[model samples]
Target chain A: MVDDEELTPLHPNHVKVLRVVTALATLPFVIVALVLEVRAFLFPGAFMVPVVLAALYVVLRIPLRRYHARGYQMGEDRLRVVKGLLFRSDTVVPFGRVQHIDVDQGPLERAYGLATLTVHTAGTHNASVTLPGLANETAMEMREAIRAHIRRDTM
Target chain B: MDSTAPTPQRTNPLGMIALAAQGLGKSALPLVAAMFGLRDEFSGIALVLVALAGVGGIMAVLAFLRWHRLTYVVGAEDIRVESGIISRAARSVPYERIQDVSLEQTLLPRLLGLVEVRFETGAGGKDELKLAYLTAEEGARLREVIRERREEEAVAGVAQEAGAEQDSPPIFAMGPGRLLRFGLFEFSLAAVAVMGGLAQQFDFILPFDIWDWEHWMELVAGPGDWIAHLGPWAQALGIMLALASLAVLGFATGIIRTFTREWGFRLDRTPKGFRRQRGLFTRTDVVMPAHRVQAVQVGTRFLRRRFGWHSLKFVSLAQDAGKASHVVAPFAKLAEIDPIIRAAGFEPESDTLDWHRAAPEYRTDSMVLVGGFFVLLALGLGIFVNPLLGFAPVALGMALVLGEQVSWQFLLHATDARQLYSRRGWLVPKSTIASRVKLHSAEISQGPLAQRRGYATLLLGLAGGTLALRGLPVERARALRAAVVESMTGTDFSELR
Candidate 1:
C-alpha cells in the first residue's frame, strides 16, 4: 500500500461538489429546526443553535476533510484507491481482472466536470470498486488504459 | 447427438403422470380432511370417492397442459427454451457460456427411465436451465452434445477425440461401515425438536393444555406417587432412563439421515472433470471442471479433529444446488484428502511456510469493548435489581472474554506463492486455501477503533466464496495486499490451468 502522502489527490473541484451535496443533505434537518423554532418548543436557541452548528460542521468542514482523506494511485497494470476517515478502505484492482468499467457523472458532478470511475470484477465480495472525485477527462483516460490492457492480453 | 435441426421437442409424455402424482400428494391431507367434514352431507363413502377422483382428474389435466406448453430446441449456437401457456417466454443460452451440464433423477423419474438435464451457466440459483423428465438416453446425449460444442468454442482449432470413455477409478467413496461410523459423529437432536414443534402445533386436539405444568403433574400423579414411594435412588434411575431414551432417539435420527444421503456416494475423475454421483432416493450427477474451482476448504469439528476425521469441499463458480461449495469428501482422513486436493491442482500447506497471528492489541481492544458493555449491564442490574443477579452477568462476561482469547489464539493466516491459507475458530475449525491468481481484487479495511489501534483486515475477493484475514497490524495487512496484488496482476488469467 502506498503512503497517504504519495497518493495523487482528486481534482480540486470535487471539494465544491462535496459541499453542495452536503448542503442538500442537511436541508431536511434545517427545516425541522425552523419548524421547531416557529412552534416555540422549549427555549428559542435549544434546537436552533445545535442544528446550525451541526449543519455548518457538515457543510463547511466535512467536505475538505473528506477531500483530503480520498486519494488514488494508478500503477502500470493495477489501480489502488484509498478513502474514508472513520472507516477506511484501501482497494487494488488489477487491470486484467476487471470484467467491465464505467464512468458516471451525477448532476452535481457534471456541473463541476467531475466523474466517478467504477471497476467491476467477477468476485462475489467487493465485486465493484468505485473511485469518485475524478476529472472527467482523467476518468475516461483511465478507462481506456484498462480496456487496452484487457484487449491486448485477450488477443 | 449432432442432429441440430432446431426442432422444438417436448419431454417424455409419461412425465405427466409423475407430475400429477406429485400434485395429488401435496394436497392429499387437506383433501381427506375436507372429505370427512362433508361426509354427513353426502351420506355415503361412494360420494367421497367421487370427489377425490374429480380432484385427481383435474390435476392430471393441468399436468398435461403444463407438459404440452413446455418445449426446448437444441440449436446450432444456443439452446432455447420457450414456455408458458398464456404468455410465451423464450430463453436462449449460448453453448460457449454454459459451464457444465448435470443430471438428476428422483424416484418417479428413475422408475420412468427419465432424468432431469440441467445446464449450469455459472450464474447460480434458478438462472440455470432445466429440462425435466427427458428420457435417460436423450439426457445423456444432450449433455455430451453441449459439452462438445463448448469445448469446440473454447479451443477453435483443436479437434477433440471421440469415445474417450476410460474414466479413472473412483477417487473417493464411502462404504456402509464407514457411513455408520460417520453417523456416530453426526448425532443430532433436530428430529426431537421437530416432533416437539408438531405436538405444539396440534395441541388443541389434546384434552388439556400440554404446556401447563399443573396439567402435566395431574397426568403423571399415579406414576409419580409410585415412584416417590420407591425412594430417591429409584427416582434418580427414572431420570437417567429418560435421558438415555433422548440420546438413543438422537443417534437413531442421525444414522437414518446419514444412510439415506450417503447410500451410494462416489466421486470419479472423468476426462472432462470430477464427476460426483450420490443419494438414495433422489440421485444427482454433477460434473465440475478442475479449472473452474476457485478455492478449497478443509473443515473439522472439535471432536472429529481428535479422531482424525475431516471434510473436503471445492468452491466453484457453478452452484451445487443453492450452495456455492460442493462437498468432495464428506468424511475422510487427511491422508485420503491429500490426493483429491492434488487432483484439483492445489497442494496442502507446507510446514516451511510462515504463519502470522492477529495483533495482540486487536484482542485487547475487543475485550475492553465487550467487557465494558457487560460491566454496564452488571451495574444496572445490581443497582435496580438483585445484586446476586448482577454476579451472573459478571461471570458471563468473564467467560466471553476467555472465549475471545481462545479464538484469537487460533486465528492465523499464511500465504505462499500460489495460494493464500487462513485458519479460524477453535471448536469448528475451517481452513480455506484460495488460489492467488484467481483472486479478483484485494482490500485492506479499517474501522474507527482499528484505525486508532493501527490494525486492519485484509479481504481477498474470490468468486462464490469469501477469504479474509482479520485483525492484522497495518504493516502486515499492507504486505499481504501487495503480495496478493502481485500474483493477481502478474498472470494472464486466460492461460491459467
Candidate 2:
C-alpha cells in the first residue's frame, strides 16, 4: 500500500563534508577566472571576477540542497533510497535479493566519521545500490543486519 | 583416471597444434597483404617472408609453452585452473557458482574432433573460464560431471543418474523449407557494400582508377551505346532488368547468411535444462537451466507479425556469445514458440490481460517536445539555408511525430500474480514477461518534465537484462513497486533451484 513515510536524512556532518568537497572542486575554476580577469585578454572589463564569484557562490550552496534531497527508508525486509533533484530516483532493494553488503570509507568520509553502505544484487543493471553519508557505526550495524537476514533466509 | 579426483590434467595434446595454427591464421591476412604490396621489390619480399617465418615460430613456441603450463583440477568442492607462463596465476570456482557449461567448435577444431569448453559463472564476461581444444567426448563428460555436482549441491544427498545421454525429441527444429522462408524475410544488401569496400581498399590492383568517372564511363560505353541505339523502350526495359537483378542479389545474400548461421538448428528439453545446437561452420552447444532464466522476451518485426512469426529469447543469468539474452527460437510461428515459452515455466500472453496504457499527459508532453525540436530546426534551415531544403525537415518531423503517437498507442504494461509484463514498440514489438520472485530490485525514476507531468518510469532489475515500464502515473508506479517488492520479499530465493 502507498504509505507516505518520511525518509530519514543523512548524518548532519555529511553537509559539512559535502561543502568542503564542493569548495575544493570549485577552487581551480575560481583561480582561473581570477587570472583571466587580471590579464584582461579579449574583452576589457571588471565583469569576469564578479561573474566567477557569483557562479562559485551559487555552486557552493548546491551541496546543502543535494544533502536535503537525498534520504533513505530502511523497511523491515527492504531498503528504499530516494535521491536527486533534477532527476529523482527511488530505488527499493529487498533483503532477500542482496548478494553482499559493503561498508567503505573514503578519505573525506573517514575524516568526517562517515561511510558509504553498498548492497550488491544479482541483477545486471542497478546491481549495486549505494547509500552514502551514514555514520560509520550505523553503516556497520546496517551491514550486519542485512547479513543476518541473508543468513537466516539461507538457513 | 577418477573423474571426481582432484588430479590436475592437461587438455588434449593436439590443442597445441590447433592453437599455433589459429595464431598463424589470424596473421595470414596481413602477411599476404604485405607480400602482395612488396611483390615489385625483391628485398621487401624477402623481408616479409622472413617476418612471416619469425611470427610463425613465435606463435608455435608460445602455444607449446601455454599448453604445457595450463592445467585444470576438478576437485570435489571446486574446479581450479592454473596457467600463465610468467605470472603463474591460478583461479578456482566452486561448483555451486558455475551457472552453465557450453561447448563450441570452430572448423579446424571440429575436424580435429575437439571442442572449446566454457564455464559461465554469471559474473559477467571477464569472469568466465574457458578450456580450449579438448576432445569432444571429454568435453561432454566434463559438462555432465559439473552439472551433476551442481545438482548434488542444490539437492543434498540426491545423486543424479550419469551417462544416460538419451536423445529427447526436439521441441523446436528448423528444416530446410522453414529456413528458406525465414531467409526470404531476411533480405539484405550487405554483400554489395562489402564488395564496394573491397574494391576501394585494393583499387591499386585494378587496371584502371576505380573512382575516376571517365574510366567508369568508358567501361560502360560499350553497353551504353548499344542500349541507346536499341531505342528508348529497350533502354527503359534494361534499367528495370538491372533493378530486378539488384533485388535478386540482396535476397541471395540474405539466404546464404541465414543458411550458414541457422543450419541444423535444434532446441531440446533435457534434464539439465534447455539445450540449443546450431551453426553450420562453427557449431555451438549451450545449455541453460530453467531456474537461471529471469524473464522471457517475445519479439516480432512488422512483416513477421503479419505472418504470425515471432522470436523467443531467454533473459538468463548466463551470457550467450556476449549477448544478455539467449535466442531460443530465432524464427518460429507463434503456435510453435508458445510451447517453448510454456516449457520454460512462462505462460504465453493472453488477450485477457489487464493492459494499461501510458498516461495521456506523458504522450502529449513527448509529442510537443519532439515536434517543437523539429519545428525549430525547420525554422533555422528556412532562414539560413534554402527554403525547399527546410520543408524536408518539417515533413520528416511530422512523420516522426506520427510514429511517436503510434508507439505510444502500443506501449502497454500489466502484471499478474507471479509475473510482470511490459510491451513496447510499433514496428518491432517486443513484450517482456519477468517473474516477480526473480527481480532483484525496483526503481522509480522521473526526469524534470516527467515529474511535472506526474508520471514516472519503473525499471525492473533482471539478472542479465532490464525490463522498463515507462510513463506510468506516479501513484500507479509506487503501487506497482510495492506489489513487486512484496512478491520479491515473500519468496525464499534459496529454494528456487
Candidate 3:
C-alpha cells in the first residue's frame, strides 16, 4: 500500500520562500497602514491604527505558514492534498477523471528548488489537484504517475 | 497519397476584397457619423484629412491586390491554408475532426462573385481557425472537397458513420410575414424608437403629425385627457390609429430583420449531418455532424410557447464560436423534433417525463435559502422604505422561490444505448445528456447548508455540456455516479470512436 521511501522530498527553503514572498508582496498594505498611523498621530482619535495593524498582521501570519508549507500524495486511484489551517482542507481527487497535469515554476520558486503541480480534470469546478512546495524532480515524477493512472483508467 | 488528388489549388481573391470591405463596413458608418459634429476650424482640416485618407485608402486598396496573398491546397488528408504578410500562418484541419464548414458571402462578395469560407473544427474558440476568401465556385469546391473527405473517412471506417437522414428539420424561412412577426416582437425597443423618430421627422404619416407629439405629451401628463377630454369616438379612433401604426411599424422592422439576417435561410440534411445556410447580403453555410455533437437543447420563450414552437441547439466540445456551437432552430413543433435529433445520432427523450428518484433524505435547503432571500429583502424594505411595499416584495419573493424549487424538476435516466441523461432547466430549460463512454468525471458536492439539508449537487462531466443535478438526495447522486462509472468501465463505447 505504501512505497514512501522512493518519493523525493521538496527543497527545504521552498515553503519559506513562498511564505516570505507572499508576506512581502503584501508590504504595500503595511506601508499604507503606517501612513494612516502617521495621519492619526497628527490628528489624534481619528484613525484606528491598532485595529488595522492587528488585521494586517493576522492576514500575513496565515499565508506565511500556509503558503509554502504543504504535502501531497498522488496515489494510483486518488490525489491527496492536506492544506490550510483554522479551516483546514484535505482533498481526494480520483485518478479516473483527471485530464492533465501541469508543472509551473515562477522566478522566485526557481531560486527555492520548488515547482507547483496542478492536476486538471474535465469539469468547470476545480478540475484538478494543486500541490505546491514540490521539488522539481518530484513534480515531474508525480505528473507522470498521475498521467499514467488517468490514461489507464479513462482508456 | 491519392493518385487522383486534384492539382489545382484555386482560391477567390475577389472574396478577399469583400472580406476587407465587410471589416471596413462595421466601423465605416460610425466614422461617417463622426464626421458630422466637428468644430468649424477643424471641419476644413477634417475635410483635408479625409481627402488624404481617401487617397491613402485608394492606394491601400491597390496594395491590397498585392498584399492579400493566400494559398489554399486540397490534399487527400486535409485542407491547408497559408496566408499572412510578414508573419505567415499556415493551418491544416483534418476532415474527421472538423465540426462544420460554412460559406459566407457579403454584399460586396455577392457583387464581386466571391464567397468567404469558414471552417469549424474540434478546437472551437472565439477565433476561427480557418478562413479564406474564395470565389463562389472555389468555395463550393472546398465544401465538396471537405464533405468528400469526411465521407471517405467514414467509408474507411476511421470515423463514425452518420445516422440515416431523418425528416428534414423545421426551417423558419423569414418571409415578409415572419419578418413582421420578428419586428413586432422587438417593437418596444428598436421599433418604437424608429417609429417615434419617423413620426417626428415626417408630418404625413399621422393625421396631425406635429399634433401627435402634442397628444403624446398630453397622454403622458394625464392619460385621462386621452379618454375623458377627447370625445369617446375620437379616443377610440386615436387608439385604433395607434394600434395600426404599431402594426405597420412592426412589419417594416420585420422586413429589415429578414433582409439583414435570414435573407436566404436554408436547412437541410446531408450525408455527413445537418447543414444550416443563411444570410441575405452575406450567405453563411454551417454544418454539424452526428457524432461530434455533445448535448441537445430545446427551448422556447414565453411569447413563443403559445405557438407550440421550440428552438434547437447542440452543445459541442469545441471552444471556439460560442454562437456557431449554438445552432438556432427558428421554429419547430414539439412533435417534429425526433427527426432533428435522429439526424445527429442522438435518440430523443421519451415524451413522458422521467421523474427523479432523489436520495431518500433529500433536503429543501436551497428552497429555504431562496425563501430566506425574500425575507431578507422584505426586512430591508421595511427598514429602509415603506412597510407595505416590503410585504409585497416578500410575498412575490416567496412565490418566486417556491416556483424555482418546483421548476428544478431534474431526472437522471439511463438509455437502452448505455447513455445517461439528466434533464434540468426551469426558467430557461435545457437538457444535458451524455454517453457513459464519454463521461469524463462526476463530482458530488455538498455545501454547509446542503449538508444540513441532506442534499448535494452532482456535476456530470461529458464531452458536450455539463449536466448538473442540484439538491439531489446525496445517496442518489453517489449511486448515479457509481452507475455511470460502472457502465463506462464495464463496456467500451470505443466503437463510436
Candidate 4:
C-alpha cells in the first residue's frame, strides 16, 4: 500500500451504498432459494449454510473490507486506481490515452452529494475505470483536470 | 438549451420520417395480427387507414421533438453534442481523440438518399457517436473533414517525432486467382457446423436411423438387394466412402462461400491511407488511416503455418461490423503480410526474426491451463458415467500439455522504434504488434498457479483490444508494469518508442 502514497480513499458513505446495492442484488436469488428450500427433494437444509455464508459475506464482510481496500490517485498526467484486498489490482491510465472523462452521479450518490469519475480509454479490458464515492465537487474537479490534460496533450 | 452554444448542427428533417417509419414497422405486425384476430370493424379499409394515419402522425411528432432537442456542434478542436428530451447531457470529444468518422448508408438511409455518420472514439463500451440521418453530401463532407484533420495530425506527428512521413505506394492488390487461393486455404467449417447443429436440433435432416443396423441396411441397400449380396466389409467400406464424400462436400461448400465474399477483393494504398474493397454484392470499401490503426495482428493455424501462410487483422476503432477486426490482411503468405505491417507505419527491427523468447514458466502455465481444462472435462465424464474413457482423455491431455510446453519455445516478444510485439500459441499461433503510442493502460494479475510459479500475467490494454502475456517473473512483471506507467508519462504521443 506504501508503494507511492498518492492513494485517496473513497467516502465513508460508499459503505452504505455498497450494502444497499448488494442487498438488492441478492434479494431475488434469496427469495427463489427460500421457496426452493421448502420443496427441495434431495437434502432439505443443504442450501442453508451456503446461502447464509454468501449473504453474510455480501452484506457484511465484502462491503466493509472492500470499501477500506479501495483507493484512487489522480495525477496531472495519469490516474491510478488500487482495488481488491485478496485479489489486489493496481490500474494506471494515462491522460493522453483517455478518450473522454465523465462525472456521473446516481440517485443514491445524488442524495449524498457524491459522484464517480469514469475515465474511458481505447482499451477493451479495464477501458472505463470508474473511481466511485468522491465528493460531487471533487469528481467535477477531477473531470476538469483530466479533460484539461487531455486537451493539452491533444494540442 | 443555451442560446450561446456555438455551431449547433442537426440531422436531416427526413430522419424524422424515417424514425416514424421504423416505429411503425416494429408495431405493425402485432397490430395487424390483433386487428384481424379480434376486431371485425377495424378490418374496414377506411378505419384501418385512419388508425394508421393517427399512429404515424404521433410518431412523426415524437421524432420531430427528439430531433429538435438534439444538436451536435463541430468546434475548433472538439465535436460537442447536446442531447436528451427531458434530461440534458453534453458530450465533447476532442478531434485528437476521434479515431475515424465513417459514413454508412443502409437500405432505408440509402433509399432516402441520406447517410449515417458515426464517430468512433477509441473508448470502451459506448464508443460510437452516431448522427442517424444526414444528406449524402453532408455525410461525405463530415467524413472528408475528419480525414483531412487526421491526415494533418499524422503529418504533424511524424514531423515532431523526427520520423520521415513515408507513405508506401500501392504495394499489392489481390488478383482473382490470388483471391481464389486465399479462399481455398481458409479452413472455415462454419457452414458444416451450422448444418450439424440444425441436424441435431431437427433429427429429420439425418435421413437414416444412426443406431439401428436394419435401418442402416435399408439405407445402404434394400433387404435382399445388391448391397445385401455384398459382404459386411463392403458395407463398412461404403459407409467410409459416404463419410469421405460428406467431408469433400463440406470443404467445397466452405470454398464457395469464401469465393462469394472475396469475389471482388482488393487491397491498395490511397494517398493518405490504406483502402480495402471487397464483397461481391454489398461492395464494401473501407479507408483506414495509418494513425487510426491501434494494432496489427498476424495469425495462422498449425497446418497453414507449415506452409508459410497466415491471416492479418488490424485492431481499429472503426465500426465496420463483420469487417473491422477480420481486416488488414484476411489470409495471405507471410511474404505478403510483411508489407502491410510496414505500410501501417510500424516496422519491426528485423522483419523475419529477432523475437525475444518468453520465460520458462510460460510452458508450465500453458500446460496447467489448457491441459487442466481437458482433464476437468475428463473428470466430469468419469464421475457421471465411464471411468475407462477417462484414462484415455487424461493421457491425451498430458500429451497435449507436453506439446504446449514445447510451444513455449516459440513464444516471443519484440519491440522496435514504434511498436511492441508478442507472438505465442501453437494450435493457432498469432503475432500481435501495437504502436507504443496506442497503449493506454496495463495490469499485472496472478492466479493461484501463477502465485506458486512465482510469475504474473501482464495485460497490456491498447485501443479496442487487450494483450495478455502470461508467466513473466514477478519482479520483471512489476518492473514492466512500473516502466509502462512511467513511459506513458515520460513519452509524448510522437515519441512513443
Among these predictions, the greatest DockQ belongs to 2
TM-scores of chain B, in order: 0.91, 0.92, 0.75, 0.68
Q: Comparing candidate 2 with candidate 4, which one achieves the higher TM-score?
A: 2
Docking class of 3: incorrect
Query: What clash pairs does model 3 have?
Result: B12-B134, B12-B135, B105-B282, B124-B319, B124-B320, B125-B319, B125-B320, B179-B254, B359-B473
lDDT of 3 by residue, B51-126 (tens): 4465447545644653366666677787777766666777877777665677766677678877667776645453
If both were scored by TM-score, which would come out higher, candidate 1 or candidate 3?
A: 1
Give lDDT tens digits, candidate 4, residues B51-157: 67766776778788888988888766677888888899888987767766766665576678787777877463365687878888887677666665665755465
| TM-scores for every predicted model | 0.92, 0.92, 0.72, 0.67
- Say which docking band candidate 1 falls in: medium
Off by over 4 Å in 2: A36-61, A152-155, B5-7, B28-58, B84-87, B157-166, B386-390
Candidate 3 C-alpha lDDT tens digits along A1-155: 22232333356666576567766766676677677867776555334566556656755566556654345555546665656543333344556656677899988878888888987755444556577788888888887876766545244
Q: Give the winner by DockQ: 3 or 4.
A: 4
lDDT of 1 at B298: 97
State residue B150's C-alpha deviation in candidate 1, in Å.
1.6
Ranking by lDDT: 1, 2, 4, 3
Off by over 4 Å in 4: A1-68, A104-115, A133-141, A152-155, B1-169, B187-224, B230-237, B322-326, B349-390, B447-453, B490-497
- DockQ scores of all models, one per candidate: 0.68, 0.69, 0.17, 0.31
Task: Check candidate 1 and list the clashing pairs.
Answer: none
Q: Residue B274 in model 3: shift from native, Å?
A: 2.4
